[model samples]
Target: MTDTTKPRIVITYCTQCQWLLRAGWMAQELLSTFGADIGEVALVPGTGGVFQIDCNDVVIWERQRDDGFPDVKTLKQRVRDQLEPGRDLGHIDRA
Candidate 1:
């Protein structure tokens, strides 16, 4: 994506696992933080323990590989790193 273009973030979660809430919550976090910095935050329903976050078609996080769901803070940082690498996430950026 170009500097003028807003990247798309897609969150794929396992519907069978009832992880939609988590995915939605992540979407909320991203939207709340990035706001106009991002174009879209989509929630894709998947299965088989799949919980992945994709930005501009690149897989940033995966549940099975990571071994667990990411907390909202961590996930937001991952997104900010992609969307705007130098952008600050306020309190979330602090350790």
Candidate 2:
């Protein structure tokens, strides 16, 4: 069951591309940074070179559309923007 009250981050990566580590790493980063701020971070397997990050069903980062994967700082910013617009991400917000 999912807690719809809080924000959910879904990371869909291409299974054929062997991007599980990448997706998992990103999930870890988000979890570590946001902590309890986010409800969950899900890793969904996909194919055809797909790599997307969705927050609460809103696509925030798409590998094809965004050109490539997002860096940690950018990912953090995007998540923060969606979940808590006014929240500061310390050094991440500085750069």
Clash pairs, model 2 backbone? none
Write model 1 residue lDDT over 19-88, tens digit each, in one string. Answer: 9998998899888888888888889999898999999998789988888988888888888787778887
Q: Residue 41 of candidate 2: its Cα lDDT?
A: 96
Worst 10 residues of 1 by lDDT: 1-10
Tell me, what's the RMSD of every candidate? 2.9, 1.2
Overlapping backbone residue pairs in candidate 1 total: 0
Best of the candidates, TM-score: 2
Candidate 2 lDDT tens digits, 12-93: 9999999999999999999999888778899999999999999999999999999999999999999988888999899888
lDDT of prediction 1: 0.87
TM-score of 2: 0.94
The most accurate candidate by lDDT is: 2
**Model 2: residues with Cα > 4 Å off, grouped in runs:** none
